[model samples]
Target: MAATDTIFALASGAGRAAVAVMRLSGPASGPILAGIAGGLPPPRRASLRRLRDAEGATLDRALVLWFPGPGSYTGEDGAELHLHGGPAVVAAVASALAALGARPAEPGEFTRRAFLNGQLDLTAAEGIADLIAAETEAQRRQALRQADGALARLHDEWAGRLARLLAHQEAAIEFAEDGLPTDLDARARAGAAALRSEITAHLADGRKGERLREGLLVAILGAPNAGKSSLLNALAGREAAIVSARAGTTRDVVEVRLVLGGVPVTLADTAGLREAADEIEQEGIRRARRRAEEADLVLAVFAADVAPDAVTLDWVARGAVPVASKVDLAPAPAAIGGTAPLPVSALTGAGLDALRARLAEEAARLAGSGDAALLTRPRHRAALSETVAWLEEAESAPLPELASEALRAALRALGRLTGRVGVEDLLDIVFRDFCIGK
Candidate 1:
């Protein structure tokens, strides 16, 4: 789709850097540079030049770069002004471009234009947004892979298989009376079942990828004086929360994020659970329970001095791992430390390494079995889930006609993922999240 107007924005981050870049695109790109910088650079070339305004007023001695249409990012003619990194200088250049017929690029408009011109597919484009928003190293790497078309490639592979299978099904259904090989129907059904299995396994991976992209929420829960505050501070590696041996010191839930094995995991330390006269402490306890249930993992912190009791029992009922804190103090109750319950002392740093390793292993497991092709966004997961549902239905179907319909529906959903079929609504929402200069 060719857009009518040109757009421009400060491509470089706003800061006191030595130089800043302002990007322009569309029909007016060449003219805009010519008006401000005397002349345009050759395609993909940068030229030294002095920039000026409409009235021949000197703005800044800047480097100008140009790219011709149909090949550049945005698949349109584009230009860049490497101007001095000053707010006023950048603003003057932007104003000059606007006067020369370029409008301010809306957030993500540059990438949006790139998408419009087929420079990147919908998933890759969204991957750009995800990459920009990534919070941890693993998130950055994962988003970068998606931005490089990992999901797109996987989807294309499945789509191609389904397309071939659909062809066979259609031929069998359409020419059955011509003494078509009787085994064609059976073969088609078997193929549908196999494809359904593939999609089912693929969609199952969506949960872990989503969790890794968003980071897992972990809650640290226990009665007051259970070393919850100490553990929070210890895990954070900084004094994010006040820590003391005094009971009920932390009256509110405190959150901290740390990278465990390249995965970002959030830890929440909640107020100690107890019969309390303080309303604030009671409120904290209530919030703690709510967050504990929402947590991807809950750490039931109890000092070795305390007995294995109802508080830790409730968490175990919901599949939480009971973590025995203060292993340096004394031996924990025999009931608490079994084959799975990990013990650590956030005080003396005893067994903390083992705890961290365990948490990382769990995060990795939840994030996927290391190499499963994961859907990085909710949109991808939703599409995959819908497609997987149909695949399941198709697998159980005996009639080739019903199975073929289900297979077609599944193929259509996968098609929407890679833009082989139009996803205008999805595209609109996805591109809307981008920054103006991409």
Candidate 2:
């Protein structure tokens, strides 16, 4: 992982394809390419070349492109070899690269170099990782916005203001003996209060960004033989769970992924809630209650022909969406616990569309469109929360010196957020999850 060592890696997908791209970055990139590819191709332009080994034995014909330092990705001399899509071709090229003193890149090494070289901040680097792993259109848009520096811009603006306040407070303290303006301390405190308010407002976004990034969890809960599994199969358009006439057919949680309103969601069908004597069924019931607690939304199902259980009624009273299952067999009650139940018959496919539409609406409301520069990670929230605390300290500090120290601490927290300063320990944690070769 040393920057002085030239690194090479397969940047494209593995296995057979139209082309396999081998990426290189370091000071020796140009020389390494020239050593193996007959000679360096025109910088930033595709040029056909016959790649060879150290012994000058031809290996493969490839398209080569050279990127000079200070302007390329990683801010270093880099090159790309578009080799023929074959395992042997890629292996030979990799061997040749190693023979020429270029070692294989570690996971996220290329992007780490880019960050160290000032090409991007930590937030942008994380955004790139999220973009690579995005599963839906909303996630993609959000990742792209963060990668394009939207989040960085917002944080940097706040940091700049905080820095100015710190500077003003320091000046007031340092120049108080020289008869400087006495109101400087008061002005800096006022500015701290204003900045704290803005940051607090941003923090109160209902965690929409984090929810959107991680996806939402919805749990289906009901008593035995309440048709909960049947409803799950109907919503998923597949028999994701075992449906049977037995009371405890589902003894564990079954989950399925679905996209609602372009936002990814995990729908979990848990075991029917009940007081069971069987140890296994009792365990399942316990797990079901735990899942319901963790769910962003819950579907409290009641059999249309049977009386609603007290447990299910309690969930509905706690804001769960009430669903009347088996509507084809029996008419749904007008209301359950003062809340109108959504009538649905999984067997006959009746009223399913309306229920799906309602779920989609809830999903959209919980995870908004990815248009705003929202906080997408827990680390971001924690850092901002610490910053707010420091700002409050600065606002209420008894001495100007203490206020200046608090302001500096707040700025350092912001610095860690964007990798502007003091992030040596965090580099590994931040980039460990990234794919190799970036």
Candidate 3:
């Protein structure tokens, strides 16, 4: 919290490895670097040096770099030490850093300082966190765009327009006493309406970006003997779920994570949907229905050898992918619920590659393929929604004064989205989720 104090942390993963990166930032960065490495390296240049302890004992040979204030990541003097990653080496360096008046950084403190010093906005800070947590290629692309200020640029453009409207409205108020023949108020109202419409349209994007950020969920549903578990195992390339000839073998949802079309997906193999005599089986059936309702996509599986069940046929009619399993046993049905079912033999690996390709295409359609800037978090949605409401109120205000007030409120809401204004309360919520090293 005190920007004047020096902070240090392991900028790399903590463990015994080839190298461990210890980062320092604050006013004392230069002196701390001097104390440990005997001198500062050229700005932004890496130099090998002998690291020493408080007793002037050689701790380890390391690489050190120094960055002067105002041009560094934290907008303050900063330094980095790449030392051999052993517990003893790290401990010795940490002890020397403490002796030289630097303390351990809190979670996100370095980035928080960067934000405070105008290196990046709040939204960009969040994007950095997302980039660190990203698990798939699509996710990495999305996070990288966000961290580069895509969302901030969009929100800033809106905020700039709102500011212009506020200024116009104020000008109208100031000149009204002179009886000046002007239509500034009318123009302001029209601008508010147009901006509100644009924001609303942006909000209508089916939450594809958020799903991509959080990953997609696909549920497998079918009759008791439809080989749903077997299909799940076949796609996951492992025995993720137990397959049995007996009905009701899967009594709960079995989840497996895999990348499809460069998007992370959680594939849930659910209990078979059918009437059951046992209470436990009935509970499993209830859970299956719930999972289908919550899933972004559903796989309606049917055994090729068995007559198509009406329950799964209904799901196929309702837009689920119709998959005919057990193709090795019998030929796939030409038509299932008025459409061709994708035939796959989960037992023999026949037609599985085609099924996987189809699923990947569907995932790309439902979740984005990382082509555009998307609203990736719930906070973005909420803030934009609130801004739209305020803009609407401004457009409909009876007086220019009220309209100006509403426009200011709208600007404030938009600011919160990009961390350009009114961000004191949001820092904790945003940075607390970050890993300490970040």
Candidate 4:
């Protein structure tokens, strides 16, 4: 599409609301705004107008806002129309714009224009996409940081440092007898070490940033009548699954999304694992075993009335955290050999605070609160990992030229993280994940 041809999309959520927004962006923004509003407002200002078609027939009374070229969202020009939130009104305005040379925007075309216009870096553009698609608090926070160019700024600093290091290396190698300093080797290695430490620090957050961007999966598993579903409800603070005095009320996996300690957890309360007579119960038990294998953390709940035993010991091989549920009913249990068992009661509030605190502490550890690392996405992790591999190369050889080359290679990989120089294919994946309106 030509950059001069204006693009428009319904910026507001579809369906009924108090009002709807239709956005137009391009060089023709002024004309389009004038055509719809019968006049263009002063730049960066909003004005109420009676919108009409080309024939002067009334369409909808809208509040029109205009943003002049070189200073607007798309960097050329942009306009917004706040029309009444009726489907017919929105459609009519859109049809009118189409008749006047505006084309419907493709998915993420608006934000793509922002990127092309240099208003946002590739990372910030993706952050915009993520922010719009955010479903949990943690995801929203991470996306907001990304959209704010936090990752881009960090990557740019590293890139600049490497560029300077590369320049010094070229001078030392090409003109050693010239004025190049003798500490070139030392300086280059030191720079590489600094960059490597930066990368290593960011990469140290083992899969927490990934889990935060994409919600974490946690499973609840244990013996029968352990109040597993009750614990799920207690943590979820709602009756997500049925609870009963009977042994196996939940015969299938019950999954729910809860912000446990500020991180989104897709908590799955699975069936009670035991030898079953019925076909469905046996199938559920099998599924429970399968889920335990894939869980990020399994909270093995047992009644406080029962003490730990060898049968329980048989199932603790997968790093499951033993949870003594219904702590109000009996004494709290202890962990086999590690941290103490977390005591909690689904009915009373006893030990619930401790559970939340423990979960928060675990989440913080996962997030690398102990380390001053800034990682926001899984893609970032992959790029940092590759960069760290090259840093390892530099550390081993310690040659100025090799270190410079390795640092450059590492910078290129991180550039992909922020879409600074090369990332056309990655942008396709990022924008494909965005909503059409975004």
Best model per TM-score:
2
Taking all chains together, each candidate's TM-score versus the true structure is: 0.89, 0.94, 0.93, 0.85
Instruction: For candidate 4, report its TM-score.
Output: 0.85
| Residue pair clashes in candidate 1 | 107-436, 108-435, 108-436, 224-272
Residue 327 alpha-carbon offset, candidate 2, angstroms: 1.2
lDDT of each: 0.79, 0.90, 0.88, 0.77
Q: After superposition, which runs of candidate 3 have C-alpha atoms over 4 Å from their true positions?
A: 421-438
- Candidate 4: C-alpha RMSD to true structure equals 7.5
**Candidate 1 deviation (Cα RMSD):** 7.0
**How well is each residue in 1-438 modelled by candidate 1, as lDDT tens digits?**
699899999988996778999998888888787878887777788789988888999999988889888889889999888998998898888888888889999999998999888898888888898888888777777888888888888887777667666666666776675665556666766886787777777776638878988899989888788888888888788888888878878877789988887788889988888888989878988998899988888888888777756777777666777788888888766565342567788878987888889888888877743244578778887787777777776767777789878877877787778774433333343345532222
Leading candidate by lDDT: 2
Q: Give candidate 3's TM-score.
A: 0.93
Ranking by TM-score: 2, 3, 1, 4
Better of 2 and 3 by lDDT: 2
Model 4 agreement with the true structure over 126-220: per-residue lDDT tens digits? 78887898776666777787788787888877766665655555455655556545776567667777888877876776776566766667788
Specify the poorest-scoring 10-residue window by lDDT in model 2.
Answer: 422-431
